[model samples]
Target: MKFEFADRVNRLPPYLFAEIEKQIKEKKAQGVDLISLSIGDPDLPPPPFVVEALKEEVANVKNHNYSFSQGEPDFRQAVAEWYKKRFNVDIAQDQVVALLGSKEGIANAARAFVNPGDRVLVPDPAYPVYANGSTILCDGEAVPMPLLEENGFKPDFDAIKAKKAKMMFLNYPNNPTSATVDKKFLKEAVEFARDNNIILCYDNAYSEVSYDGYKAPSILEVDGAMDVAIEFSSLSKTFNITGDRIAFAVGNKQLVGGLTKIKSQVDSGPPVYTQKVAVKALAAYKSAEPPEFLKKNNQILSERRDTLVECLGDVGFPCEKPKATFYVWVNCKGDSMEFAAKLLSVGVAVTPGVGFGKHGEGYARITFTQPKERIIEASERIRKLFK
Candidate 1:
């Protein structure tokens, strides 16, 4: 007998990054020296204190056992405290649901909230996980809320209201687009969610990776937001703990409870040692000033963004300089996948925007995750190809 596949799993568009990885492997096999600007995985190391804490916790036999499903109390408290300090929003430990990573929380949140055939509002050119999680796992429909350059990549309230979706996914210092929502936009979104009886799922993974004196605001900062919003944050990008799989969801108690309940049935909490280390990470993050290394890193990437913009302009593929995050959402002159493939042939790896959504057609997402010298080299190579 042949094995059967579930319809939902079969219906998901090919996992974009996996396809990129395959192409990367093929190119490497062909002896191509690829300069990868495809994914946003950070290249930085976690703070030294975090590493030391992990070592200490691993040495303690007590930490070898399973942690609580909702995570270690200290970890939850630290997350709550960090949110209070960072966003100035008071949240209780019960309001926090620690996750192995925000991605898992996002998927589990959809499973918890979305019923079959429910409409989920996701931004166009948004994070792919939002739609995939809703559609593939929750049996929901994703109604794309078009995000355009004209609107500063912010969702149009009227359009979203028309959809009347049960849940809306909002990401700022946004992935792919690198668009940051201002306080006004966040307030408007909160009001919209409340008025529409919608659950606002805010992905704030890049909240701490900002530059240009612009701080990313949490949707929870808006008044009454906690009544209707749940914000997911990750130490992945912020503290360079991507491999640690430590993140949290904080907001409405009921929503957090729903997620926690689902999580309890599915898996045990993140490793006890990881949570112990996370406590130290959060504490260090609270007291530590921005280090000179990150300052220089951001400056270098900022310059790379400018250089990339100029280079693309010279090649007639102009793009707006993004204010935060490491991605540049480029409007490809024609088909996104074709352009990406062409670039890849030349040993440059960029993510095709169409892989994000239909609204992402004719665009590509270029990440500045590569080293500065490689970024400059990639820009030159891309310029030569286009010119």
Candidate 2:
């Protein structure tokens, strides 16, 4: 017998990373030495201290049981403290909710607040979860806010056509685009959301991944943000702990409580052992400076980013070196999908800009997640094909 998927599931565009994974597998099966620069999964391991902490936490029998739906108290308090120390933003423990990952929290937050007919302002060429995993799954209409190059890959707030969008998602140290924004821009975004009576969802997953002394800010750092915005941040990218499924949503108690309620019905919070480890991870933030491990990790990624950008420029696909994130957004000047496929033929796999959204059509995103030597090798492969 055949089965029909629910409308929500059916509405999702083909998951971009899933399709990329399949292509990578097919290429490997053909005995091609493929170098995948498609997905954002980090090749680095979590700091040794994090690993050691996890090992100790798992041995405690209490950690094996179910945690509070919101989160363990210790973990929530750690989140609150970290916000103060890192962003100079004050938040209470009650305003924090642990997440399996920011991805799950984003989708569940949509479910908590968005009504079937509500409109959500989403940036084009964004991480697909904003539109696909979140808004569309809630039967909400996703209004595109194009992130154009002329505007530094940020959405032009005045151009938004939606008169009454219920929500808006924004990311900095952005995925796919690698765009960075200042606190001033975030303040404007907060004002825009407040003026429009829209709920703002800021994804700060790449907050710790920066280079050239650039630091990312929390939306809550803006004065009025606490009233209108909720931010999702992850240890996944920051601490190279993606597999641990640790992240949180902070700011706006109502928003955090609503998401926590949804999570209570659907699943338990993140694993107790992981939260315990994450607490230690967050506690490492003593002052404004990042932990030594994170600094070292960013250094490796910075070197790789430089090598890849230089190689791409040499091959005639000129792109700017982003000050944050491990991605380089290249202007391929043609059909991004075809350009990506052409590179794949040369054993270098990149994410086609079209997979992100229509505006991503003429671009391609290259990640420097691999070792520096591997990045150089991939660049040589692209140069051989393009130059």
Candidate 3:
């Protein structure tokens, strides 16, 4: 007999990064020296303090046990305090839900709120999780909100077919596009969510990995936002703990509770020691003076962005310097896949924009996740090939 699969899994579109990985592997097999500019994962080590914290806790057998479904209180408390220090938004201790990562929280939240046929508002050229694992897995319909270049990649609120969407996913200092929104637009989004009874989920994963004096704000900073919004954050980009899978979901007690309920039924929780390590990392950030490691990371990213923009800009690629996020969104003014394929042919791998969403069609997103030397070399290669 043939094995059967769920309709939900079968119906979803192809995973973009997986396809990129396949092409990468194939190129490598042919002896191609591929300079990958695809994935947004950070390539640097986290703070020494975070690693030390993990080492300290791992020795304590007490931390080897299964953590609470709602997550450790110390971890949650540290997250809350970090929020207060970073965004100046007061969060009650109970409103925070510790997550394996923000990605897990996002998927669970969608499971919590989206019933079959419910509409989910996702930004065009968005992080794939919002439209894929979150919405489709819940049997919900995805409604795309275009983040046009004319609007600085901020959603065209007036243009969005204002409807009763159950959830709206937003990423600022965004992935793929690297668009950052100010608090004023955030206020508008909050009001819209409140009026429409929408659950606004802001993925501020790239919050700390910003550039050029740009500080990304949490949606919870807006007045009355807690009544309708839940913000997800990650240490993946901020502290280079991607492998650690540590993050938190905060804001809107009811929404956090809902996500927790779903998580409890599925998985117990991430390892307890990792949560302890997260506590130390967040508490360190709670200080008035930002850590040197974080500062150094952002500086390197900023330099990479400049180097890439200068090289690509010289070849008439029309890449605007993004305010935050290490990605520089470029419009190839042609098919995104074709452009990406061309880059791969020249031993440079990049993410095709159309893989993000329909509106991503003439664009490609290049990341600054590699070392400065590799980035410079990739830029030179791209310039030559693009010309």
**Alpha carbon lDDT of each predicted model:** 0.85, 0.93, 0.88
Model 1 weakest 10-residue run by lDDT:
285-294
Backbone collisions counted per model: 0, 0, 0
**Deviating ranges (above 4 Å) for candidate 2:** none
Against the correct fold, how does model 2 do in TM-score?
Answer: 0.99
Number of the candidate with higher lDDT, 2 or 3: 2
Judging by TM-score against the true structure, name the best candidate.
2
Q: Candidate order by lDDT, highest to lowest?
A: 2, 3, 1
Query: In the order shown, what is each candidate's alpha-carbon RMSD?
Result: 1.8, 0.8, 1.1
- TM-score for model 1? 0.95
A best-first ranking of the candidates according to their TM-score comes to 2, 3, 1
- Pairs in steric clash, model 3: none
Ten contiguous residues with the weakest lDDT in model 2 = 155-164
Deviation (Å) of 270 in candidate 1 = 1.0
Q: CA shift at 95, candidate 1, in angstroms?
A: 0.5
TM-scores for every candidate against the unseen true structure: 0.95, 0.99, 0.98
Model 1 CA deviation exceeding 4 Å by range: 161-164, 287-297
Candidate 3 lDDT over residue span 81-169, tens digit each = 89889989898778988888899999999999999999999999899999899999999999999888899888977777758689998
Candidate 1, 176-261: lDDT as tens digits: 88888888999999998988899999999988776776778888899999999999998888777799898989999999999999
